[model samples]
Target: MTDAAAGARTTAPILLGVVPFGLVAGVTAVEAGMSPVQAVAMSVVVFAGASQLAAIELVGDTAPVAVIVATALVINLRFVMYSASIAPYLRRLGAPARWVSAYVLTDQAYAVSLAEFRETAPGERSRLWYYLGSALSLWVTWQVATAVGAVAGAAVPAGLSLEFAVPLTFLALLVPAVEDRHTAAVAAVSGVVGVGAAVLPFDLGIVTAGAVGVAVGVALDLRTGAFPVTGDGEPMGDGGRERETDDAAGERGGERR
Candidate 1:
């Protein structure tokens, strides 16, 4: 199967999980007193569901704009890690393509695309197409679902427990990603720390837990020699592959000259 088609197919199940969250986000926005245009626009522009929900709740509480913005930023801080993890795979893309990629870098897209990238050969040209396929599918589904929720208003019943899908989807992705003792330890530490830190202000708990987990993982790696860092501060395994590719390309060019 083609990369894009494969990506779209892989993402289909998760799309079902996202629908209710999108619908809830739309309904919540209107119930929170935002105009229809504003609600839809937020979904289109921000495109981050958890942050949107947080921002809407803050707005409903009549929080200051600065507070709302800061809260949203903190809640979305995981995107920084996501961007860093995906950067090497996408570095060859031009500025505009990279920008588009960044814009559509949601949790589902990142999870599926990153798994695909790690398994696929490094030099394959279909990675970006696959990512785009997953992202576009998500984008369209979110917009349509949110629009429906906005129009339906509160008529969508709350007892449906639509929110469960979000965590369920993450859990599905997380299960396969935890491949070793160190990774399992990291996940355990991060989940516990995140929950323990949940009372922190400005939604800082998630970010703090992530930082602590990463630090523990890095220290473990250093002791085990699993992920030694090069002088350039890149992970030795993947970075070495990139450097070898560059050197080989340069040698071929010189020979031709």
Candidate 2:
């Protein structure tokens, strides 16, 4: 198949996975006593699973609105990091594109896009397009699933363990994406810290664990100089292996090869 076809084929399963999870979130939100409209709106506007789940958890308990909003905000604080990381690429995009991109900026979109950017050649714009295609596929699926769930929320029986669906979905998505040792370490540490802090009130454990993981990653990057910087603001190179080229033949002969 052609590359575009291949990209579409590969992006299909990931988008499929987003559906059931989004449905579960929508169902749980309504089951938690949120109006169907409210639940659907949250999925449409917020779109962050963790934050939505946190808010739903609080809303279920009849917590104060302030508490629910605060917890949701805290759970979603990680998006700031995601935004910063992707800003360089999006800076050239016009205001309309920027707004749309920000609206669709979920964890999966950011992760998949960044991975594509790193793996593809700098000269190719198709990588970015592929990422956007995959993300938009997932985004559309989520909105549809959420709407379905909101309408069918009452039909989903109680005590069905649907709450675990979200985390399990995240696990399936993230486990395959840990391609490097540093990323693996960050995931492990973050998981441990997040679980350890689970007892903290108002979902503070998530924030704490996230902060620790970010610090660990940043420190590792600095120590290894994984991303090299030059005076001219170019990535000189570091950490990853250097390509070997034959001087006379002007051909490649990599140690890796």
Candidate 3:
């Protein structure tokens, strides 16, 4: 397929995924004590998902504004790695272009764009379009969802458990991304830390758990030479093969993706 066509096709799933995520963010922001206007403004101005959610969660807890901002920064710091990952592609795109691209760099857009960029031949390349399309879809969906969720958050029963939807979304995203022993080890470590830290007050456990997870993942990657290994240190496996297998199993087992 031509790069243009491939980029467009690969971006469709992101549109679908963003609809629910955006709405969830909106609703949660309202629940976090923002007015509808403020909640919607957040979706428009700061489109990063985890950071926005972290901010809302902090506000809900009545935490200091500095702590809330700090948590948002921690959650969003991953984007620095993402920007570096895609820097080679964006370097020649000019400063304003690069900044715009960076602004729209959500996880869903990054995932789909990187996959398309790798697949497309240079002569047919269109990474920018793929990223833009996916990001636009997500941005629009999030705004609409937030509006809906603001209304629905009031009517939805606490017992029906809509709160799980956001984390469940992350789990779906994360499970697919964990295709190696190194990542699996990190996830295990994070889970252990989170469980152990559950007694901590005011959701600090989440921050600790995320730090432990990242530290474990980084340590495992260094130990295994997964991040910078030259040829043939270990057998080459599909980076996403484990994710595919688990998703297949989930389908068969009637498990949620």
Candidate 4:
């Protein structure tokens, strides 16, 4: 299958979480007295589910718009890291294409695209297509599901309690990522910290939890003398190798003298 097609196919199953999540966002937007147009517009514009839900909840509470905007931005600050992580794959795109890709970026998009990119060759065009395929599929699915919920209004079942799907979906992605002991430690600590910090206001707990997890992972990797690899798949900071090369050159010079 083509890279784009493969990305779409891989992303299909993950949308199980996204489906109900979008439905809830749409239903909540309408419940907050948003017109169906405004609701879907928020989806198209924001595209981040956690921030969208949080903003809608604030809207229902009649919170000031400034507070709503601040909350959304704070919640999405993690995207700075996500963008950095994926920059290598999408850097070859034109500015306009990068902007579009940024708008469509989501947790699921990042997860699925990263998985696909790992398998694909280092071709910029193929990588971009795969990322777009997965992200756009999510975009389309979310918009349609949200529109249905907004128009249907109370017609969508309350019994489904679709909120549960959100966590389950994240858990699905989390499992594959925790492939090693270091990662497992990070995940365990982060999960505990996140749950403990859930009492924090404005959903700062997620940010705090993420920070702690990253710190743990970084510490473990450093202790093991591991570092990030560069684009050429070379270890970024192997001072030992450089020093060894220098020593060999010096020994050769001494022998010649």
Candidate 5:
């Protein structure tokens, strides 16, 4: 399958997990007194469900605009770590493509794409296409689901417990993504720190937990050489092989001939 096609296929199953979350976000926005247009616009523009939900809850409580913005930004801080982790693979893309990729980056996209990128032989991977395919699928699904929720606001029953789907989605991705002891430690530390810090003001706990988790993970990786480096200073894949370039493959073929 083409890279994009593969990404879409890989992403399809996860999309089901996000549907209820998207609906909750949309329904919550409307319940917070936002008009349907405003609710759907937030889905289209902000596109981060967790932050959107936080913002909507704050709005419902009549929080100040500055507080809402700050809270949303703080809650979304994990994107920084996600960006740093994926930068190595996407650095070769042009500026426009990179910008689009950055905009579409999400937990699902990052989890799926990073897993695929780490497993595939580098020479055979099309990182951008895979990323775009996964992200765009999410974008479209979120928009549609949010729109449905907005229109069906208050009509959908409250006992559905749709909000639970959000965490479940992350849990589904988290299991397979934690490939080694270092990552498992990172997850454990982050979850513990996040819970302990949950009482912090302005939802800063999430940010604190993410930063600590990343730091712990990186320190362990460096100490253990979990991330092997190629001779050219590029990081090797999980298999300890440097990604082969097309030219390098051609050279090997010629040599064999």
Candidate 6:
């Protein structure tokens, strides 16, 4: 099967959770007095469900614009980590493609792609198609589900409590990543911090917990000479196939001249 097809197939099962999360986002938007158009726009534009929901919460609280912005930023800070992790496979694209990729860089996309990246060491062309396929699958689902939720609004029913899908979905992605003591330590630290700081204003606790978790991971890495993935994502060693390809191209140029 084509790489894109593989990516789409890999992402298919996750949509069960995504559907409800998107629906909740849409319903939450309308319940907060957003126009269907505005809610849809945000889904298409921001495309980050956690940030969108957090922003909605702040808006409902009549919080200041600064707090809302800060909350969104805090929630999305994970993307910095995501970008750094995936840059090796994706950095070869042109500026425009990079821009498009950035927009579609959801947690689901990043998690799944990184796992695939480590295993396949797929070439750049394959990586692009695969990532786009996985990311677009999610992008389409979020938009449609949100639109439906916006239109359905209160009719979505309170008993479903669709909000639970968000955490459960994240847990699904996270479980595979914690394969060792270091990762387990990081998860433990982040969990404790997140629960303890749950009452913090503007959802700063989320970032706070993440930051602590990352720091602990880093310290452990540095101390144990685990400086990098230790195997997975060995960005230099794995994706360096592209670097080798580049050198080969330059040598061919020299011989041709």
Best by lDDT: 5
Q: Which residue pairs clash in candidate 2? A: none
RMSD of each: 3.5, 5.5, 11.4, 5.5, 2.9, 4.3
Error of 2 at 245 (Å): 12
Against the true structure, candidate 6 reaches a TM-score of 0.86
Compute the lDDT for candidate 6: 0.86
- The digit string of per-residue lDDT tens for model 6 on 46-132 reads 899999999987787888999888889988988887787788777668998898889899999998898888767677778988998
Provide backbone clash counts, one per model.
0, 0, 4, 0, 0, 0
Model 3 error, position 107 (Å): 1.8
Instruction: Kindly state the number of residue pairs that clash in model 4.
Output: 0
Which residue pairs clash within candidate 5?
A: none
Q: Which pairs in model 6 have colliding backbones? A: none
Query: lDDT of each prediction vs. the true structure?
Result: 0.85, 0.71, 0.66, 0.84, 0.86, 0.86
lDDT of 1: 0.85
Ten-residue stretch with the least lDDT total in model 5: 238-247
Q: Point out where model 2 deviates above 4 Å.
A: 1-9, 122-128, 228-257
lDDT of 5 by residue, 182-202 (tens): 789999999999999999987
The true-versus-predicted C-alpha distance at residue 250 of model 2, in Å, is 15
Q: Compared with the true structure, what per-residue lDDT tens digits does model 4 show for residues 1-257? A: 38778789988998888899999999999999999999999998898999999999999999999999999998998787778768866666899989988999988889888765654444677777888889899999999989988998888889988999999999988898877788799999999999999999889998889888878878987899776545444223343345457768999999999
Model 4, stretches more than 4 Å misplaced? Answer: 231-257
Give the TM-score of each candidate: 0.87, 0.79, 0.67, 0.86, 0.90, 0.86
* Residue 191 C-alpha lDDT in model 5: 94
Off by over 4 Å in 6: 227-234, 237-257
Q: Is candidate 1 or candidate 6 better by lDDT?
A: 6
Q: Report the number of the highest-TM-score candidate.
A: 5
